[model samples]
Target: MMTHPSGLILPESRLSDLMREHPHTIPVFLRHHMVCVGCWMSKFDTVADAVWNYGLDMETFLRELNQSAQSIPPQGTD
Candidate 1:
């Protein structure tokens, strides 16, 4: 899995992985217009980048991302 000290990068997967595992992340994900969080595009996109797309503060959004990510463990990592 792609590791990030700040959990910025996803857990080595597509955006769909987050969507599939963490339902609570939907609002935040959508807020960033990451409606495709369930698509392959998410894999390539970082949480910080997503927030930038939404024109939000990266640090705050990263907090939200870390919160959301907490619910979804990487595949087979649990």
Candidate 2:
């Protein structure tokens, strides 16, 4: 439960939890070429785990994820 600047997402946050809570972030993961969307390990892996496995820059990944999370409207909202 590492706290990040975005407050909405953290490095230790699980992929399933993040997607369930903020589906908009799904595109961000895909954009980064992460196969976490439907991966079985997503339930157990954290964002940091995915980033490290994919050899991505932590700051850039977190920034994009946070931006997407912040920009998307709540589900069912007009």
TM-score for each of the candidates: 0.51, 0.81
Alpha carbon lDDT at 11, candidate 2:
82
- lDDT by residue for model 2 over 1-78, one digit each (tens)? 433444567788877777776788899988877789989888899988998999998888888888887787534312
**Tens digit of lDDT per residue, candidate 1, span 1-78?**
243545454534334545554556667777766655556577676554565566777667657766776767644434
C-alpha positional error of residue 50 in candidate 2 after TM-score superposition, expressed in Å: 0.4
Pairing residues by index, what is the TM-score of model 1? 0.51
RMSD of each: 4.4, 3.8
**Which residue runs of candidate 2 sit more than 4 Å off their true CA positions?**
1-7, 74-78
| Model 2: lDDT to the true structure | 0.78
lDDT of 1: 0.57
Task: Pick out the ten consecutive residues of candidate 1 with the lowest summed lDDT.
Answer: 6-15
